[model samples]
Target: MHTPDPHRHTPVPPVRPTRRAAALALAAATAAVGLVVAAQGGAGAAVQGSLAADTQFYKDPTSQVVKWVAANPGDSRTQVISKRIASQPQGIWFSNYRPDSVTSDVRAVTSAAAQAGQVPVLVAYAIPNRDCGGASAGGAPDLPSYDAWVGKFAAGLGSSRTVVVLEPDSIALTTCLSAQQQNDRFASLARAVTTIHAANPNAKVYLDGGHSTWNSAAEQANRLRGAGVLNADGFFTNVSNFNTTANESSFARNVLNALGNPGNLHAVIDTSRNGNGPAGSAWCDPSGRRIGNYPTAATNDSAVDAFLWIKPPGEADGCAAAAGTFVPDIAYQLAQNAPDPSTPSQPPSSQPPTSQPPTSQPPTSQPPAGNAACSIAYRANSWAGGFTADVTVKNTGSAAISGWTLGWTFPGDQKVTSAWNARVTQSGAAVTATDLGYNGTLAAGASTAFGLQATYGSNNTTPTAFTLNGTACTTS
Candidate 1:
């Protein structure tokens, strides 16, 4: 008789982390709005309020952001970053082809989630020619090695529910491969899916279906079919891409329809950084983007399986830093720029408001006596004709500032289109940003942040001069 696996039957203790009660309330409030999902195992519902406090998806304690937070306790951005970006559940990427360690590595994460009675999102990215020789390259040397590696990967599921995002860009970006090579790749993907399902029937494996803006739905469906999508649970879209959730949802539904809407097939979308939508077709670390909806299985759409953060926010897309490396500044910017969760719901606007110069002038407050009153830190990410900037206003004075207005003049022809955390208005190259009541007060040595999205014609230079309440401020 075969001995049963020892790791399979570990008893899961009751999960009652302190944040669970509060998360339940937030989840209930947003359930009607399609922001929260029911918890796995039917124990209770979960929301994305605190670090996997109430979500079915497990929050990996060893995630890059978590390590960053622990390493930099005194960083000014730590509090917000900890509460927002670091607290969320993100995909744990298994990108290497280390067959010897792959099973144990996978088991560690899955077993942790199992003990917590939560599901884990895992990305299988070790396919040959990964990323089409782009920034994220390297994988198993050949198809046979990859096939064996995938079998070991599947063996680590350990009798619990899990979500696996298999080989992003595999089906969608196979243009460079020859006819026979493409056929071989598809065969490998199909075999991997079979192995995963056979290993753990509780595992839901999703194949790659590129974003809405990439291939047409019919074309993607055909490719997914060729890669054995019918045998898989469904396909996933927008992995690591910045496409809006609404657009992705529609695109996924269209793809399902094209795939004959098999009852067993569905779609999951990567809503990691599509809150502000795409910056045209520019995919590599574009600016002005925000974190989208928190990961949830209750998308309220029958055709869609779940909305996932397949790409962890703040990890560079090979531009800002090496690909997959987490940058703290980007993480802070994304969390700070996210929409206010407590704001009342409003009708979705189809178009951005027309850009026009400010009609009213900034408040005329007398200048403070010295340059020590305030200082500013400005950082920006630019691509082609557009960019986004994050500005931090530090109170370098001894007294509290009850209200504040920040003014600056662009050295170039940059035009502000929209803003967040403050009210921004532009006239010619001059811009004024006033506190929006909530963030006006800054105690001695305290700081606050705001951001803006803008466009430029030929140049995009940082503004050197700034003023807070009409007092000149130093720049960094």
Candidate 2:
């Protein structure tokens, strides 16, 4: 958990109207303008309504971006920041170690969310030795104090539907502790999970399972079991990291399978800033990263509960600024880099729009080849002799793909070492990847990504050609 910087806190003006209130007011105003004007604005209104309707998570109006936007209304980037970052639902972190006021502080957010019939995502981040003396270091002075603090934190839930991401990097980053210290920490976390459930049975507490690239699935599952995850709701992966959602989802399921699929456990992934995936293993604020899938619980995968904005988009990861400090420039960059929601799913081509329809209308005598129905976008971060690549496969055809096998040939002498989300095999320079059951189906216009870790001798040239199920695919 990244501690909030007190010195960087911006004074929030008065608390403005809540999002639900403002949306209601806008609907009333739009109705007063009559049918023609309402018709013109229908698409935008529907988009907003659909977003609200899809998620049960609460959007806190007093979030960092909200306060920043309110304080700097005249700023040039305010409009985009307000609409893209401030308006989204994100976790409200309780990182400060204030036992006395912690209950009230947590109650305020939970109570407000309950009143609006929405679930609040809360991060319980006061575990002892947090961040292991890294940039986000400093938690409770000892484990005993942390247990008491977590009890107070749980008291604030007050029977509301809530999600508590318990101590990110707590179980995953334990190399700094000795063997006994690690055992003590695990017992402390187990007790804390019990305390939370005892206080609020309705609350869903998740242990941290780390990110995909951090540890192997079997290793993470063993750590999770030691932390009493079987008694909790499940585990969360990539809390504040930038791993892609598809990789995280596959890793999470593998972890669950290793755990013997205990109870009704499910995982939630932090997709707040992973739209462009990771920049190798860089955990700090990286450039060119974009806001990922918007906060939602309607994930198609049963093993995954939700895709959350656990790490708010604008906050720095200690490198760009003090950890957890909101930076408007980073917020603008992330929002601006995200894909335009209204744009067509197909990637832009050199041909003009007017001529596209004529070319798309193929003769009925022969249907479009399977090779022309798919596209792939590959991105890699390389250093020295090794690199990690994320490949996104989009099915642009009219029908769904039930199962898929992707093939590519490396231009350089690259050998696949390990992969996630798909089973990969390499023969000389040729690489073939097949789905791992859970991610096989791709509906029309839908996309799924898989990643691999590989080694190259000197040159790390990316593969230019790709094929899906023996059919050629367009590459970007």
lDDT of 2 by residue, 259-352 (tens): 9987569887776766655543445776766666556554545676666777777777767887766789988987774543222122111111
Who wins the TM-score comparison? 2
lDDT measured at residue 356 in model 2 versus the true structure, 0 to 100: 9
lDDT by residue (1-476, candidate 1, tens digit) is: 00000011111222111110000000111111112122222222422221222346777666667779999999999987786667666666777567997787788778888887778777777789866776666789999999999999898888888888888888888877998999899999999999999999889898989866566678889989999999998988877776556657777888999999888888877766666555534567766566666666655566666667767777667667666667788877766755443333222232221111123443434434444499999988676666778799999999988778899999999998656557789999999997655466788999877776677899898899998888899888
Give lDDT per model, in order: 0.68, 0.67
Residue pairs whose backbone atoms clash in candidate 2: none
TM-score per model over all chains: 0.64, 0.67
